[model samples]
Target: MRFNTAPAPHLAPTASTRRIMQWVLVAMAPGIAAQLWQFGPGVLINLALAIATALLTESAMLRLRAQPSRAGLSDWSAVLTAALLAVSLPPIAPWWISVFGALFAIVIGKQLYGGLGYNPFNPAMVGYAVLLISFPKPMTAWLPPTDLAATPLGLLDAWSAIAHRAGPAGSSFDALAMATPLDTLKTQLGLGRTMDEVQSGPLFGALAGKGWQWVNLGYLAGGLWLLRRGLIAWQIPAGFLAALGGLSLGFYLLEPQTYPTPLFHLFAGATMLGAFFIATDPVTASTTPKGRLIYGALIGGLVFVIRSWGGYPDGVAFAVLLLNLAAPTIDHYTRPRVYGHPG
Candidate 1:
């Protein structure tokens, strides 16, 4: 009898990294659209710059390593990293910011260690952390939501603001930039103000903040889609949200005048985005089911700690990077035993 078996991998692959990356980009659409509606074209402008720079840097790195550029580029990991880093930046950040960030993300964060899955840290988060540490002022120059902006710029004017060019009718870039809702709350809390007093501002919308709730919801919706499609593990997001919300509820209940509501914490900053998209990154996250829950919970706890007391208003990036360092250890301890093996 003739055997029909080839080499290994007799079953065809159900998914590719490229395909997964494409789905991630698609999942980001709603959140991106919300940002555009709230802050205008700054995100798009930065995204274009970051993508171009990431591709160039990736190509150069691939050539240096004597690898096929098309295979690397077609994988879409570079694009996703670029998009994530670009989106995380302040909308009015200068063009050089995105360019520099993309360079760092692809070259140092990813390729320096061999590229893609080889890198231990999330490339986008690395770029973001570096930018945050290096350029604190520019990194925090977020524009207020359109309704709250005193002089909201049009698409051309937004580009001009990013370009450091004078806006139409002498509108200034500084006029548009302000603290994010999270920053505002943090500052007010530092100043010993009650939640009720802080919530009176236009910055605080019905749920979280002006435009922020919708952005978080959009991401949550996209995240749900990915879950349904089986592209990501539910344990990570579930554990993250549960811990964050649970902690927030505890603090808020203890001092209603001090801490904000659980919904505010859930819908604020990068909570949903980090929980759904960033924390669930398969490479930096744990492999085992139980390990993932512990990993995500630790991240969530660190986020709460940082936001409550640390310097940064949002701690998602830092939390994720810190947790990335522990993923291997978590997997080691949580590894399942063989069915027939004795302890």
Candidate 2:
């Protein structure tokens, strides 16, 4: 009998990167649908444009780098990054904004750093931050929640708005644009208004902003679904929310006039999204369970600090990016000890 041996051993079948990314995309669907329903058709248009631009840019870069385009595209990582970026951006922002952001994410943020696994930052957040800083006006121009709009944009109107800066329904894009709840709170706080006064405004939907609360709830539902599917673990989200809520509660209890309620901090802006999705990016976040908790706590703390003191109305992107920078150090320090090794 002759024994044949190969240089490398074959492994059993398991989940592929593409399958993981696909699940992530699926988990985002509820939030995306809710955004479309609440904010009109601009979100859908942005999603389409961003996806196209990301795929195009990814393909072009792969070809230039002498890598197989089909394999790279099949991973769905680029599409997930594009979708995340698109959802975070202002729904009514011009077509060029999404195009530029997606291209920058795929090329500069992801590829220039040697593609997905090598990138230090979350590609989607990098794109969002770039657009937010470069085009302040458009980036902050969130549409009034569907209920508040005088004339909600239809699909054709949304297309026209992106294409021409005016809707087919004869409304200027500016007319449809409105400040988000976090923006309103930040501006009001800057003006020296108390939380009570700001809460009296129509924008305050129940505990959070009006239409925005439902959007947050939708995202929360999706996040929980992801948790149930085992696509994500509970440690990150639990730690993030616990830290954020703990801090917010402490502050609000100390000074009710100045600080908003803990519920507001949890429901407003991208708190839920950041906690579940953004901060949990496998490539950019800590790997150890203990490290993940620490990482998430840091993000939550930073978010509170930035929202309360920093110039930006919402701090999810900044918080996530800052935490991403610290993830490696966190992993290094928090790695589990070997079972048979001495301390």
On lDDT, the leading prediction is 1
* Residue-level lDDT for 98 in candidate 2: 97
lDDT of 2 by residue, 206-312 (tens): 76887778877878998998899888878889889999999999999999999999999999899888888888899998999999999999999999999999988
TM-score, model 2 to reference:
0.96
Candidate 1 per-residue lDDT, tens place, 1-343, comes to: 9978799877989999999999999999999999888888888999999999999999999999999999999999999999999889988898899999999999989999998889999999999999999999889988888778766667788788788745557866566678999899999989989899999998998889997888898899999999999999999999899999999999999999989899999999998899989999888899899999999999998999899899999999999999999999999999988799974
**TM-scores for every predicted model:** 0.97, 0.96
Residue 190 deviation, candidate 1, in Å?
A: 1.0
Question: What's the CA RMSD of model 2 in angstroms?
Answer: 1.7
Query: lDDT, candidate 2, residue 244?
Result: 92
Model 2 has an lDDT value of: 0.89
Off by over 4 Å in 2: 1-13, 167-169
**Largest TM-score belongs to which candidate?**
1
* CA shift of 99, model 1, Å: 0.8
Clash count for each candidate, listed in order shown:
0, 2
> Residue 158: error of model 2 in Å?
1.2
